[model samples]
Target: MLMKAALMETLLEKFYKNHQILHKESFMLNQQNMKIFTQSWRPYSTLQLKGLVAMVRYNSESSWLFELTSVAIAKAGFLVCAIDLQGHGYSDGLAGHIPNIEPIVSDCIQFFDSIKVDHPKLPAFIYGESLGGAIAILVCLKQKREWNGLILNGLMWEISAKFKPTWPLEKLLPVAAFLAPIWKIVISKPLASKSYKEWKRKLVVKNPNRKAPGKPPMATALELLRVSEYVRRHCHELEVTMLMVHGEDDVVCVYRSARFVYESAASEDKILKFSKYVASVDW
Candidate 1:
């Protein structure tokens, strides 16, 4: 019994030491800082996809925003920065008043110019979620030669154009977007992922004092759909290769949209990849 007790005590000591090492490693990893260029700009106004927005991104980092989709970019082999488009984050602007698809593309171009990197020919990768994907596609269309790669998550292209007929919605879009109204188009229903819910809940839990703003402007839907249709017809114009990924269980944005992008985009070097949220990738 005495020998057995001594062995148990030794095992406990080893376990405690291992736990402490893990704790320290985690703290260091979390503390790691990726250089970010945070700026606010008023992109030239157009018909839709308008307003001044804040851009919080990392340009000095070696790799681009490829490794992580959610959260402030993780330090990866690729330099990373996640942009919160205008009228969305800390930037100034009314929620409504998106002019048209052209402005959306222009904003991204403006962002690239504002960054002013030495290498105009380096492999710059961008990741956009939902509406961001739509803009990402548009940006690539304009400057295909300049960028080397693209990444998108839950792209917003799947939303039907037949949705909210343009003539009717366009007339009211300014009003609704001004109101920042919410419209239930393609809700996740019972199929919603628990992980997203947990993530959302934790975010809210962590910041209980702050309430997330209402749905984006109704004009957003109008501008997004218009952009989607435009991209569909002009997919042949996109020249940059894109690496695509979408969730199998994503209900808000369907999986077929990624397929459409792969099949339709003019990019010859494009590759399609599938991944789940919160999963780790070695590359």
Candidate 2:
């Protein structure tokens, strides 16, 4: 009995040692004086790393949800890193209030470039979900020939028409945005109900930090609309290899928008995959 107990203790010790070796750390990176919360999952087992995957998270969401995914990637001998965008997660700025995407995109470039410089020999890829996907595309576009590939899940290529603001509100958005950019306006329908599947709906509510406002600030809404259109127009100019996955039943972002990018992109290697479930399942 003593020998058996000793064996169990030894196994437990190895488990904890391996866990320690995974090396999970969080730090603040200063970008223009904004403390961007960044996290990295790295494997300390070998020198020849699989690759580095720089992640951009979904809209109104933080990098915390990506922790499990990052750990899995690290276990597979890869380095995974992600940053909380301005106004999301633990980062500075008003929550869920991005008036313009340019600054966010610039932050990505600066942080990602710094990571690349540290590990100059490792091949790097970009992975994004929802709004993060758009940011990833803009980043890759700005630094042409820098990244190896892109993996986007449930990308916000198109904002569904149903989610758009009501007639008068839509027409008056420009003026309202100018007048009261910080005012939060509720949409006719709740965004959470449409975003997650029936089973995963509870997970959304379970998150303590989840930003649950269905209505966006007028400025943010207008900026999102403009950004989607800009990405749609310029998607064809993308030269990097891309793999886009989307749920067919997604009521948030239109699936056709992803198809449009696949068809429009000048990339020699690009793929568009449609899934059976909803957006929540894709992640």
Candidate 3:
């Protein structure tokens, strides 16, 4: 399984010019969101890519990035599954509510199982962006057999935030987890040029179909903290043939982590690429 990643803008344009989409089955979302999903369901499966971003945001710009990436991989003749993580996109979970990375990665396994039920013994690969990249990494580590290669885009190892007396906030993060469930914070800025600040909006927030800004659920935040603790104490646990891309100015997640990931990866073939603008590279 060979994995590759591209920037939202360039990838979208290439996808638009050279791809096709066809609807497949509708992956059920959480109970509350089923109504919205049902209205325009039946999205692309491996054989099709027609109904890409509509599931998350009816006309979202970022839709095709995932759709195209999945399609390109499939077209090139590989078994691939594009996921909605836990609470985002058209998966079965609440928005911004993640109890832990384990469950989400578990869902990923179930998804692979669903695929295996149809095509047993087939291999698979993953392409993850932002936090999704971390989820992909966990899959490779925890479910080693499930993945072959990984393409990580803006993968996050650290959350950029200001916590005065960081220790106190770290201790209270749990209690605050429940009491302040609805409180959303802008923990960091995009790691790109000022020019890209406006452009990235299409992939994450400004795009009508994107569901990423959904507040990180307490459970999800807890998992993030756990990942942070692990990285702080044991980043050496990472072991995968991953291609990591980061914006030189990315602030949403620290650039230093990208360096750490590149330097600390256990795989000899791992490649790290940094850029001021978004791009897709061969690693």
Candidate 4:
């Protein structure tokens, strides 16, 4: 029995060794001198490296499931790296507060550029989900002709009517934001509940780094609306190879808005895919 157990342990170790990936985590200070959490994954197999992929997570999401996605990409022969935006994950800032997106965009650019310095010859791709999609677009715009490809999953081109503030509240948002930047505003439903399937929702909420599901801060909500409009105005300038995937049933970020951007974008090689019954993070 002892011999059999030893053999089983040895076989398990061999299996893991064959499939192992190099995963690392670290902290970097952004321009604002805030500590930002960063992670990277590289496959240990003998396969030739294909390219580099930089991932950006949506608002309120950290490195939880995002790390799983990164590992999968790494296993496919690409070096995958991701960063936690300020105010989210293990980063240092006011929790869930993003008053201005430009700084965050700058942070991503700085980190990605640092990584690219080590692999200047490899094709680089930027992948963003939800709000991160908007950030990714901004990043590409800032560094025009730098990235090889851009992938947006459930991009938040426009906040869904089902999710945004209602009539009077929408009109008064600016005033509220000005008066109380940190005050949380009421929304229709918790984003996690609407964005994930049952099992996935449970896993998402279980994340210790995840901010509690509720209304976003008044300032953050206002800034997001403005950011959406900004992206709409600039999307036509996008020339990188692009792939956009959105769920037809997503109520947090409108699918129609993604279609509009897909049509407007100047990328000669762009594909837009619509899934039947997917949600925000389901892709």
Candidate 5:
């Protein structure tokens, strides 16, 4: 029995040793001196990389499943990297409290720019999902012509009407936010319930780093609305090569709003795809 156990352990070690990708996890201090969790994946061998992909996660998502996606991309010959946004994952901040989007955007730019510096010659792409998609757009806007392509999955150009707080609550959001920034407001349902397919919902919620499912903080909710409006205003200014994918059934982010932004962007090389049975968290 002892010999058999030793053999099994050796086999497992060899299997991991031969894995085709190199995965790394580290932390970096942002401008505010907060330690932000970051991760990267690249091909293990000396194969020439096709490009670099910088990823951003959704508002409530952490580095868990995002790391799987990165490894897949890395195996396909790209260097993939992602940062855990403040207040999410292993990063430092108040849990799920984002009073402003600009600083978050700045953090992404700072991290992604540093990664780009290491791969200056390779073509680079920025990819984001859900709220991350909105941040990816903001990143492209801030660094016009720097990225080779921008890819958005279930882009949250605007919050779905079905998910927003009811009329009176929506109208009173600003006042509530002013009085109690951390106050959680009751919305329709937890986004995870609506955004993920039946089978995938379990996988997403199993994330240990995930925040509890409930209403968003008053300030964060209000700021999301403002950010959506800001993005809509600047959609016409987007001129990067782009590919946008959104699910028609997505109730967390407005599908119509995503299509509107697709049509509104100035990118000559752009494609918009709609999937019928998919949801915002289908990824």
Candidate 6:
């Protein structure tokens, strides 16, 4: 029994040591003056590396939740990296607020371009979750023919009308967005309960730092609505190799939007996958 215990202890020690050697790091990336929080995990191998994957997280969430997924991808022979966008997680700005997504897209392009210089030979892929998936598509559209591939998990191609603001409020959003952009209006129900399955929903609730309130700021809400429309109009412009996987019954992002993007994109190598239960990949 003592010998078996010792063996287990040795295995645990090696596991942690290997994890340490995987070259994981968290640092602040300066996009102009905005300090974007970023994290990365590199495979602990001397062999030729596969590629680099840049992760864009779902909205209203931080990079912390995506850390485990990044590590897993790194272990799969790719250098995996993720960032907390300006308004979310440890980054600067108000919680869950972005008046414009173009700046956010610019920040990603700058960060990824800087890193790619250090890794010139390897192909780079963009992986996005929920709202991040929309951001990834826009990024690819901005820099056409640059990315090798795109992987979207439960992407927000079209937000369900159930999440939309009510009649009078929807009509007032234009002026409200301009006058009081920071006002947190209840547009939809709480996403945590709808986003995950039962057991995983409990885990999300237990995350102390998670910004559970799904309320969107006046301007931010307006921007998301506009962004969704813009993505739909230009979906046919997406020409990169792509794989989009979605849950059949996702209430947060919906399933039909995923199907629309898969069918609309110009990419010949695109694929759309459906699963029994789907939610954010950051978990």
- Compared with the true structure, what per-residue lDDT tens digits does model 3 show for residues 128-209? 6665666566666775545555677766656656321255555776787778764653322433333235545454444435
Which residue segments of model 2 deviate by more than 4 Å? 1-23, 211-214, 281-283
Which of candidates 1 and 2 reaches a greater lDDT? 2
Using lDDT as the measure, name the better of candidate 1 and candidate 5: 5
Segments of candidate 6 deviating more than 4 angstroms: 1-23, 26-31, 60-62, 212-214, 281-283
- The C-alpha lDDT values of all candidates are 0.46, 0.75, 0.51, 0.82, 0.80, 0.78
lDDT of 6 by residue, 156-241 (tens): 86767886556888888889999999998876655555776787667667665666555778888888778888999998999999
lDDT by residue (35-88, candidate 4, tens digit) is 998888888853588999999875644466666678778888998888888887
Off by over 4 Å in 3: 1-18, 21-23, 28-65, 72-79, 116-123, 161-171, 178-197, 200-214, 217-219, 231-235, 278-283
Q: Which scores higher on lDDT, 1 or 6?
A: 6
Estimate the overall C-alpha local distance difference test score of candidate 3.
Answer: 0.51
For model 2, how does the per-residue alpha-carbon lDDT over 1-283 read when each residue is reduced to its tens digit?
7897687557645753666445444556565688887767777765869888998874544433455566677778887788888877788887667899888988888877878898888889998888788889989888888999988888875777776667888788889889999898763456766767775666556555566454567788788778778898898889998889998888777788778888988999988999986774211
Residue 65, candidate 1: Cα error in Å is 14
Candidate 1 has what TM-score? Answer: 0.59
- List where candidate 1 sits over 4 angstroms from the true fold: 1-74, 119-121, 160-197, 204-210, 276-283
- Of the pair 3 and 4, which is ahead by lDDT? 4
**Model 4's TM-score against the true structure:** 0.89
Among these predictions, the greatest lDDT belongs to 4
Could you tell me how far off, in angstroms, the CA of residue 117 lies in candidate 5 after the best superposition? 0.5
Instruction: Please identify model 4 stretches exceeding 4 Å from their true place.
Output: 1-19, 281-283
Tens-digit lDDT track for model 5 on 1-283?
Answer: 7897687557544643566766677898998899888877788764599999999875654455666677778888898889888887788998778899888888888888889998899899999888788889998999999999999988876766766667898888899999999998774444655776786677777665555565668898888889878899998999999999888877677788888989999999999998975555421
Which window of 10 residues has the lowest lDDT sum in candidate 3?
51-60
TM-scores, all candidates, are 0.59, 0.86, 0.65, 0.89, 0.89, 0.88
Considering lDDT, where higher is better, how would the candidates rank from best to worst?
4, 5, 6, 2, 3, 1
What lDDT, from 0 to 1, does candidate 5 have? Answer: 0.80
Instruction: Report the Cα lDDT for residue 68, model 6.
Output: 58
Q: Which candidate model has the greater lDDT, 5 or 6?
A: 5
